[model samples]
Target: HMTVISAREELVAFYERRGYRRTGVLTPFPYDDERFGLPQRPGLAFELLIKPLV
Candidate 1:
């Protein structure tokens, strides 16, 4: 159960301020393969932020 957010890095800090913790997981996105998606770009990677309910 999770939601993925993708966009310009300018919003990185914005999310962090809201209590989203930066995750250690990152992956190089395959720009040419349809396995990922239709749109592709250079230096594109996935960043994860998680918040857990206690």
Candidate 2:
């Protein structure tokens, strides 16, 4: 299983082309949490991606 940000459409597409699929799981960006850093913009979120190696 893998996860990626939906913000990066190109990256998501690249992974999808390589056999990855969206898991429909979305995680909101940590706006309040400073662990990652302050978001430059609002409404930022991450989308979950998955792939099976079997």
Candidate 3:
């Protein structure tokens, strides 16, 4: 299982403290076209985070 958050570096660090690690960033994102008729915002991307359950 994995969780990811597309946010600032500080936010990623915050998740890191909670056992989440920075795997990578999401490659393809439809930032140009509006999905669901929603407005577009900058830095609105996806990041990959993973945490191992033990």
Candidate 4:
């Protein structure tokens, strides 16, 4: 299991090319948390991706 920023299409495509698929799960970006960095725009989220090793 892995998660990547949904906003990063290139990164998602990279993983997809390597056999990863979206799990349709999303996690909102932590805009309220300074540790995660402040959002300069809205609608940021993480998309869950998964691949079976079998």
Per lDDT, the best of the predicted structures is 4
How do all the candidates rank in terms of lDDT, highest first? 4, 2, 3, 1
Candidate 1 has a TM-score of 0.57
TM-score of 4: 0.88
Clash tally for model 4: 0
lDDT of 4 at 38: 75
Q: Write the residue-wise lDDT of candidate 2 on 1-54 in tens digits.
A: 677767889999999999899988999887888887877888888888888787
| Candidate 4 positional error at 4, Å | 0.7
* TM-scores, each model vs. reference: 0.57, 0.79, 0.56, 0.88
Superposed by TM-score, candidate 1 places the C-alpha of residue 54 at a distance from the truth, in angstroms, of 3.9
Residue lDDT tens for model 3, 21-45? 8877574455666662453555556
Q: What is the C-alpha RMSD of each candidate to the true structure, in Å?
A: 3.3, 1.3, 3.3, 0.9
Model 1 C-alpha lDDT per residue in residues 1-54, reported as the tens digit of each score: 122434555676677677777775776666878877776446776667787666
lDDT of 4 by residue, 1-54 (tens): 899999999999999999999988999998889998878889999999999898
In the predicted model 4, the residue pairs found to clash are none
Candidate 3: pairs in clash: none
Give the number of the best model, judged by TM-score. Answer: 4
What number of clashing residue pairs does each candidate have, in the order they appear?
0, 0, 0, 0
lDDT of 3: 0.66
